[model samples]
Target: MIVTEIEEFSEIRVRARAYLCFLLQRYIPNYVPEPSLDNIINALKILKKELPQAEAFYILDKKGMQIIDAISNNSEYRRGKGINRSMRAYYYRAVREKRCILTDPYPSLLSHNLTVTASYPVYDDNKQLAFIICVDISLKDLLKLFHPSSIDSYFGHFTKISYSFFSLALLIVAILLLMKGVGSFFIMAFELRHINIKEIFESTILITLSLAIFDLVKTLFEEEVLGRHKKREASDIHKTMIRFLGSIVIALSIEALMLVFKFAIIDPQKIMFAVYLIGAVTLLLFGLSFYLKSISNIKEEE
Candidate 1:
């Protein structure tokens, strides 16, 4: 959630900065009052039309006193006039650096709602600071502009919810498998009144399968629901695969070992099957090792 918020904020800031720069370059001195107050108000009107999310537009002189309030509402403009904003971070940063800046979301004094301020510094003919243009945007409107598509947002939310339910279902199945394994072992022990080698081998196989299911559930929950193993980088993908596949390799090796013992003592004729299982396990381990080595080499090259 934090990562998502950061990403959204970054996108909003970048867009606001670019748009402010465009406005400054194209609609200059007119907005600087060198042309006329009418020109400045017209420029502000054009900006408001282009960016509907912009709640208000104001031009502040180098002294940080409101020079012109071009907001649609006259009463609101009158109320905002002559306000000093020299101490505000957004105003100070833009004037000091002579650049455009987008401030983090802050509560608006008038509306008491979250707002982001985009400030652009205007320069006079001598390249001295002339005026600072400010645009007030609400956080809700900023998000709408950032996302743009309602369908994408809804689909993304649905995907997260579905993944959560899928992880929960896998967890329930794992628990049931574990219970089945334990119940089978108890039933056999009580009925036979003896712990025979064959019965022990069967119980072990059941328990191993239950364990494998549990491992899969854990991996799914961590990767999908908790997001503990997100694949952002090549190394992240490699680590996730290693953890998930390592469990499977261990389970397969155990099953193969059990098969070998069963064939050697109870059924010698089935020894070839055990040999084949061992060969498969060996090949899997070799492939996994090669993949890990390749990942390490790639990281070194980087």
Candidate 2:
């Protein structure tokens, strides 16, 4: 009798997997728009009308990236939550194959339940790959699926406000650091003997131009080239290092000017101009080093 029961259990598992695969094949690849949140919303509406058993749904990019459903989806008691971010890879698989996918039962930690989902990929009219659409189904009120309750004391719950504040604080710190770099350059320039305004102006141009160019180039081209295969990129950290190292290089050039003032040429006063030249070259070198180091680190990270 025990052996018979074991055979039945295995049969159930096989049937479940088959049903999921069937659902994906039937309705996924043609389901949603590219991963824009607006189209995702519309897709959700249509899914509700056509498949009321569905609990929730989402569309992700080829990278298994969740395109936001606007401010509508958030982690809150009243707000909506979709799949946990960890499932991104599973969804991305369908996107890569440009086909539909269905997952066997998986646990949703947030919702504290086991559920099954099927993912569909949307393609452009050109038949180019677009995004993945995931659907959850249970024969009950769909909205309740996202509500993680009845055992809250067992695990810590968080407020979305805290997450927002953390992001804001990071942005504010970035602004302050940029302003500080500008101020430090002017203060150091003023300290030297008979500092000409022209030297300060030129140094300012070199520092600002190098940093901006470094930021843009690194983000657009370097990050893409180095992080193409990786799941995530290190763009932010790279920008930070570029600015820091470039500033240090510029500071050293300032010291070089002090050197030229003391002994490099017969005209001791001419050392000031020489200092500006050294500072510019130093910043340029530092920028290059920063760029190369960042690209190398991205390769390692990948």
Candidate 3:
């Protein structure tokens, strides 16, 4: 029962956030003479007539229905304050949490300026809640994130089977390239079998493609992923340095292994190994240069 109640509350919040985003992004900027509740409402009404699609936006004062930017388009729409005469759930949540909230149902006559509101509590330079950003939102736009349409629903199923098959084939090819690179690098260095450089390059390409796909997946569901403040850990910079060192070491290890094979096994030649030495040394120098530059900058700041 408690879980259900929490879910219901969450739904309401999204609607509010949506409304807030709508107003702030689209209508709020029009009122340039210092932002206020009355000006915000006036901007919405102007937007509704000009744009027609914007008639759904609104605002509320302490008195019930203190201001609705629009109420004429919909038949059941009624303007002015409703029964409640205090701070709304949306307003209270923003003031309390200091975070943007986008909940369900949206700013509708049913809930009376409740619904999806995207609101951020505005803070003055002195760090006080001067106002709350409220936006009326569309619920349909939000739901497309969590439960996307199935493949069948997306492409009409078997009719687009060939497209799916083609993608699968590409994925398989990428995997093969990665495997070949890994196998070549391992074998050439392991004294086991012939190492193929072509395979290694193919693997690298596939790995890059796979990472791109993963990034795209994150992009598709980004709305839900927002709200959390990105708190960079103390170790972020340290780990970044370590990863840079590791990449250099591993890449050299691969090239060195190949050089050992080319000169020791196939033929006695110093030329092939010389470039590898230069690159390894150059990478180390690059890291050192960056470290020195950072130190210099810090000292200047101090």
Candidate 4:
């Protein structure tokens, strides 16, 4: 559940950060260089009404020491004064960057759930760091405020259902191919001496293709239905395509070899067909290699 919420948060992170920055910009600039505690709390109370989903709001000194107790609708999170937050990413990052920044989701000590903090640096009259304004929101609540089509939402549920059906159909097909390929070996009642080379090659091709399809199905189900986040690396992005193409290359190479052996033993005049198959396999290999190189270069540049 935490993983899903974190993944969901990532989708809406940009929008959430922009909205939080905008909110802070509207308020934090007014309270620079030492605002009274009551005044700050009153302002945060108004801000809380504007962003009712926010868990807590607080102020931190330039050095990341809490300036006052937190202002929150929930009483339990309202007493956190004097805590040093200098080591927190929200504090250090906002201070270092001198901008409104959102921290990544992490387990919250107060709420015991995934939480994200948006910190805004406040500059004084001399344009020196004065204080930091921070807002904490639970990951789920943050998504509710920002994500229009969250996985718990209607559209997301429909998408997952669609992917599940497609994955199930592909899984069935892979299972059928697997069964057929394995059954081929038993055609001679498990007698190794009676096994046909052609049958062995055909079974290998079927098994390879089935493995490829299964891999694709797994990738699709995990990414689309389960919302599993994969890295943007070249290998991760094009894994399914690489697997399918690799399987095709392997199967074709095997078929070409089988054809060459059969033609050499029977009709040497038709060896050109095997040559063509081998040439096609080689082209596929080249194409796959080129694809890998292009994506790797793109990743490196990024």
Candidate 5:
């Protein structure tokens, strides 16, 4: 999965670079020494028709101040005049390096969507930097342009469907377990008249296990099958693991406590085994908690 995502990103970057070069070649020759309003308007029209994905086009002076704002007619957002972008990495890199560059994805100030900026340095007759031409491309559009084949899309759909089926199966199992636990409790309470504490303890463990299984299945359905999450990041993985482990720890602790109580009342000699079990589970819980915390801290630093 990681390798596939990396390859897709690399391919998109190459395609975006090529697209930016084509625009630079076609538009640079139309530059006038002292561009008038008509020149800017005509250039904007040509760019709008040629590059449909480009959100906006900018002509920035040597100092990285907007000289011409040829906002795309199809775009709902527009930029104000004379906005200084000298400190922006894209502006600095294009101006200093004198090369066409594609920027990493960032939130667009206009529409607040993820966007990538392709910048090219425009030089005048004296071979000095005259202006920087920038084209804004929405990340959504860029990804769609280089989207995977239908086979991959179909495979993804299949995976989600499989997850949904698996989750439904788990839900059915959980419900059956819950009904069994309830039946066991009723039998102990009414039929047996609560003579055996062990039976009650067993019923409680069954109920807890059933609830835990149901919780896990619900989480899987929401996160995987239903696509409730946008993407699974490091934090999401960490949280999922922590929740799963915590549930197990809680269930084990409850079972151990019940064992200890039963042993204390019936056979005190076997209480040592329950003590050891509780100690081991407690140690594991502490270790897992510490490990998760350290991992979370490291990811935050990164």
Candidate 6:
């Protein structure tokens, strides 16, 4: 469950960071004249009113020491005073970047759950660092705030269930095709003296198609249901499409070859039909090549 939440967070991390930075810059002044802890706390309280999803808010002095207790609706997160936060990523990152930044999700001591920290560096009127304002929000709460289609939501669960049923059905079909293809091969193997070339080609086609469908099922299950990331070299959807089409092209080519051989042996006049089928297969191969080239160009542009 935590892994899933992290995956979802990564998907929306850029948007979350931008929104948090915008909010912090809008509510908290970039530079104040001798700002006090009470003034920062009041600003955080107002910010919390605007964003009820935040778990905790705390102010850290320029040296990365908590100046006062945290302000949070939950009591557990309200006792963070006198803590040394200089070693934390949020504290150091704010000092390094000199701007508002959002930290990656990590386990929170107060909530015992994965939480992200948004840190905003405050400066004094004389251009010296004054303090940093930090807010903590659970990954689940942040997802709910920004992404309505998160896996924990109703629509997301429904989509996962639908994909599961479709994948199961496709998997069963692949298994049946594999079984039939294997049986055909075994039967052909036993009767080697009276071998049928057409039967061999048919079995090969069945196996090829079955393997393509199985690949499709695996990709769909992993990407849609498990939220796994695909390799950057190619998109999963495009790769699946290419594999399925390539299988069909191979099966058609085999059929055309079988027809040419059969017609040349039995009825030479009917070989022209095999010629037409070969032409169609050639056209399909060309189309698939074009599709690949187009996607490659798009990736390069990106």
TM-score of each: 0.72, 0.33, 0.39, 0.65, 0.51, 0.78
Model 1 spans with C-alpha error above 4 angstroms? 11-16, 23-38, 67-81, 104-115, 138-144, 147-152, 185-192, 196-239, 265-267, 294-302
Model 1 lDDT at residue 300 = 92
lDDT of 5 at 42: 68
lDDT string for model 1 (1-302, tens) is: 43444455565677766766687557755233354445666777787777776778888888898876447433453357788888887799887787878888877875677778888777755677777788887766676666552112554456557877887787787677667768778888687856666556556666666666666666666655554443356676666678667756776777788888888988999989989988988999999999999988988999
How many clashing pairs per prediction, in order? 0, 1, 34, 0, 0, 0
Between 2 and 5, whose TM-score is larger? 5
TM-score of 4: 0.65
Candidate 4 residue-wise lDDT at 110: 81
Superposing all C-alpha atoms, what RMSD in Å does each candidate have to the true structure? 4.6, 18.6, 11.7, 5.4, 8.8, 3.9
For model 3, residues 29-79, the per-residue Cα lDDT tens digits are: 422334576665576566556533322444544232334433435545444
Question: How many steric overlaps does candidate 2 have?
Answer: 1
When 3 and 5 are scored with lDDT, the better candidate is: 5
Q: Number of the top candidate by lDDT?
A: 6
Which candidate order results from sorting by lDDT in descending order?
A: 6, 4, 5, 1, 2, 3
Model 2, poorest ten-residue lDDT window? 148-157
Winning candidate number (TM-score): 6
In the range 124-214, model 5's lDDT, one tens digit per residue, is 5567777777888776666655654211255556877888899999899889988988988777667664467667667777777787788
* CA shift of 56, model 3, Å: 3.3
Model 1 TM: 0.72
lDDT of 3 at 250: 51
Candidate 1: pairs in clash: none
Model 4 alpha-carbon drift over 4 Å, by segment: 1-15, 28-39, 60-69, 73-75, 81-101, 104-106, 121-132, 143-165, 190-202, 221-229, 236-240, 250-286, 289-302
Checking candidate 5 for backbone clashes, the offending pairs are: none
Candidate with more favorable, higher TM-score: 3 or 6:
6
**Positional deviation of 83 in candidate 1, in angstroms?**
3.4
* Alpha carbon deviation, residue 210, candidate 6 (Å): 0.5
